[model samples]
Target chain A: MTLDALIQRLRDFADARDWNPDHTPKNLVMALAGETGELTALFQWLTPDQSRQAMGDPHLRERVLDEIADVLLYLTRLADVLGVDLLAAANAKIDRNELRFPARQA
Target chain B: MTLDALIQRLRDFADARDWNPDHTPKNLVMALAGETGELTALFQWLTPDQSRQAMGDPHLRERVLDEIADVLLYLTRLADVLGVDLLAAANAKIDRNELRFPARQA
Candidate 1:
């Protein structure tokens, strides 16, 4: 599936739930942030090494993947509403970073 | 810049700071979660409408963007360490979602 397809699915999901009006950029961003927090909470008490091995637990991995999915869905929706192409934006961000923190120079 | 470039930059950033040892998948995920929390905190008390208008404040917008960059950076790094292609995984996820939440059926 392409990003376009994902965007369409999100639109359908929102339309089905009559959430279009509420799925504004700000709301979506907030939701994305919330989901991110949830994802983090899953590993809140783990040591760094423990966190590294988190996915070794099937249930924990499943939960982590679900939270990741939530974050991605909200992020894509927010970008779609704002007319931002996530892939392009991500690429552009990398370009900017190249200048700000030159790898060779660093 | 491509995703590969971004991944390289992340590698460089970690290498420059001697953070590679600490950049385990778990550590990266934890950092990502922490950043997400910070991002959500920015709009914690805001109503949905207020969240939508969040970027109208220049300072707030800047902070939001910074947090977003941080999240994306960490996400990409996490994916990299885990040998997952962020774009491909995202696409696969959408494909699965299409089956789970059929647009026309929904």
Candidate 2:
């Protein structure tokens, strides 16, 4: 499924579970951090190859994916609640960066 | 000032600039990346001390602080618009991380 579709599904899932209320910017940030930790757990000190091969277990893959999705979903919801056009803000920042870091140096 | 106060002031600044509408998740993400680049520019290949010393110039310090604030403001706006409680979310994420990366391992 498309990313947008997946996000929608995730949103719906949250809404259905009445979990949306707990998704304040503060809460989402915490949740995102938690999920990031989960993602990190998959590769604390493993070799690069071992980390890459983490998807070997279907169940484990699903679990990891779920945590990652949770992070993204909460972030998306955070953006929505704050009335942010993340894409536009991001592009503007890029322009600033180009000025700050010239291509020659980069 | 407190972080909350600073954030509130930032929101006011963005609102005054008519920039909030453009802060969609995508735009904010892009803006964040750009600001990150700016932050990175001050330290490319430089020693940590040199990077820290770059703040010697008051104007430069202001510029750097402004860029960093911009990144955070956009992110906060993104979260606000999306209804995410960033603090709560962050805390949740930390908890998840604790589970994923226990203290001994971390």
Candidate 3:
């Protein structure tokens, strides 16, 4: 599904729960930060090799994927609240990054 | 720009820096986790209200947006290495979340 479609689903989900009042851009940003923390927590204390191999453990992988999903969902919602087009922003970021870290120069 | 386009740019960036060998899935995941931590650190002492108003402080907001971009770029790279379609996975996750947090019950 497209990012817009997912955003709409999130909107519907929030509307259904009367969560709109709480889903402001700021709140969503905060929530996104919290979720990011959770995602990071899963890999805490792991060596780089262990972190890379984390997904090899089925149970651990499931937990990690869930955290990843949470972070993305919150990000999508935050973008929606702020009227930011996540895809567009991401694309623009890449363009800037290309200039900053040019392949030929880097 | 599409997510695919951004992913391609990231791949190209890595190639330019000869960073491909260091960008393995495990390394990407670890990097992602680290970036998430940086994102979370920005909100560490803020109350909910402060967090929501974080972006009002121009410098803080810029920092926050940069962290957000960092988290996303790493995630996109990790998905590329793992052969995961981030959009598909996000959609699937919303489906599951709907079941788990049904509007009617939530």
Candidate 4:
């Protein structure tokens, strides 16, 4: 699905649960941090191969994806709430980086 | 120090170690995934407060920060190697998201 559609689904999910209030930019940042911790749970002790294979397991993969989606949704909302253009920010930072790490010498 | 300086340091670090060759975009992306796993290790089962406190511990925090730095450094190098502007990409993505989720009705 398109990123737009994915965001809408998250909005619908949050609305159904009345969790939007807790999704203020600041709160969402905190929640992202928390959920990131949860996502990390899946690979606590596994080797790299195990971690990638875990992603192949439907049950485990779904849970991990959900956690990641949770964080991404909150981030999207947070950016939306603050009137920040994530893509713009990313692009601008990237431009600056180009000058810092020029290609000719790299 | 400036972000540029930080990146220069990373370049120096990689060059001294002769790991620049392994920092191709693809490899850096993989390395990032790996370091992310390590960063996540510090707070596998900790409560939110505990996780925050863990960041305050010098040794543990250092390791976690190192892991995070490793990911960021690789990301920077990867972007450098690919000639991709991270900030530009971020900004561009953010702009697209703005149109996808407008604020007035949100």
Candidate 5:
């Protein structure tokens, strides 16, 4: 499915549950943190190499995938609630990063 | 820009900086947490109503916009590095939610 489709599905899922009231930007951001925390916990103490390698382990990979999806979902919902366009915001930041971290001369 | 274009830009940014070594899943997750922390701090003490209102404040709105971008960029990066398809993962989760939180009859 496309990104927009997935976001709409999230909105629909929440609507189905009568969860829009609870999906305020505040609650969405908090839920985002909770999901991010879970994602972080999975990689907390692994050495850099182990962390990358974890993706190859079926069980670890599933959990990591789940947390990442959760974080993305909540973040997407927060942006939707705030009427902020995430791709545009991210693209703007990328442009800013270009200026902030200018390419070095070869 | 499309999501894939933005992701390619992120990859190029890291490549230019020789930052692939630093973009390990563990480090990316930690960085993701740091950004989410900042986002959470913005809403920490605000009441739900106040939290929603903060988005109406120009300064708060800009910061909120920036933090959400950072969260998305890092998440997109993490997913890319892990070879996990975010749209697919989120789609899978939505499907699970359908079963887990089945819609109630009115």
Candidate 6:
């Protein structure tokens, strides 16, 4: 599904609960931090190699993906509420990064 | 740009810097958490109304968007490095949420 479609669904889900009033940027960002914290916990103790292989097991993969799904959902919701065009902002940031971190010559 | 396109560009940017060894899931998730923390700080003290109006000021808007851009970039990188299809996972989660929170009859 497209980002727009997913955003619409998320909005609908919240609206059904009459949650627009509670989905303020402050609230959303706090919720987002909590989700990110949980996500970090999943990979926190793993060594680099174990981290790379951390998702090999179905159970761990599901847990990791679940957290990721939460992270992205809140992130996109925050962007929408802030009137930020996530794709455009990301593209612009990358454009700046390309200049900031130019390729080193071989 | 589509998420896939942005993801590829992110990968290219990291690869140019020979960042693969360092971009382990653990590192990426930690990085993501840092970005999310920065994003949270932007609105941490704002009240709900102030937070809603946070981006109205052009200067504040730019700073907020920059953090969000960073947050999304690290998040997508973590997903890519872990082989998670962000869109699919998000959609699946929404599907589950829909079941969990049905619309109330008015």
Task: Give me the candidate number with maximum lDDT.
Answer: 6
Residue B32, candidate 3: alpha-carbon lDDT: 72
**Model 5 residue B5 CA deviation in Å:** 1.5
> Which stretches of candidate 3 lie above 4 Å from their native place?
A104-106, B24-67
On residues B22-61, what C-alpha lDDT tens digit does candidate 3 reach at each position? 8766677667767766867877788756766777788986
Q: Write the per-residue lDDT of candidate 5 for residues B1-106, one digit (tens) a residue.
A: 6778878989898888788999999999999999999999989988888887877899999999899999999999999999988888988877787888887644
The sequence of per-residue lDDT tens digits that candidate 6 reaches over residues A69-100 is 99999998988888888888999999988888
Sort order, lDDT high to low: 6, 5, 3, 1, 4, 2
lDDT of each: 0.71, 0.50, 0.74, 0.53, 0.89, 0.90
For model 4, state the Cα shift of residue B22 in Å.
2.5
Error of 4 at A18 (Å): 12
- lDDT (Cα, tens digit) per residue for candidate 4, span A24-106: 54355455456555756655666644554565577875565455444445545544544444444434444555566565433
lDDT of 4 at B28: 50
CA deviation > 4 Å runs, candidate 2: A1-106, B2-11, B14-20, B48-60
Q: Interface Cα RMSD per model, in Å?
A: 3.6, 15.4, 3.4, 10.1, 1.3, 1.0
Q: How well does each candidate superpose onto the true structure, as a TM-score?
A: 0.72, 0.43, 0.78, 0.46, 0.96, 0.97
On residues A1-106, what C-alpha lDDT tens digit does candidate 5 reach at each position?
Answer: 6678877888888887889889887898899999999999999889999998988899999999889889989998998888888899999998899889887645
Docking class of 2: incorrect
DockQ of each: 0.34, 0.03, 0.38, 0.06, 0.76, 0.83
DockQ of 4: 0.06
Candidate 3 steric clashes:
1
Residue pairs with backbone overlap in model 6: none
Question: TM-score: which is higher, 4 or 5?
Answer: 5
* Collision pairs in model 5: none
Q: What TM-score does model 5 achieve against the real structure?
A: 0.96
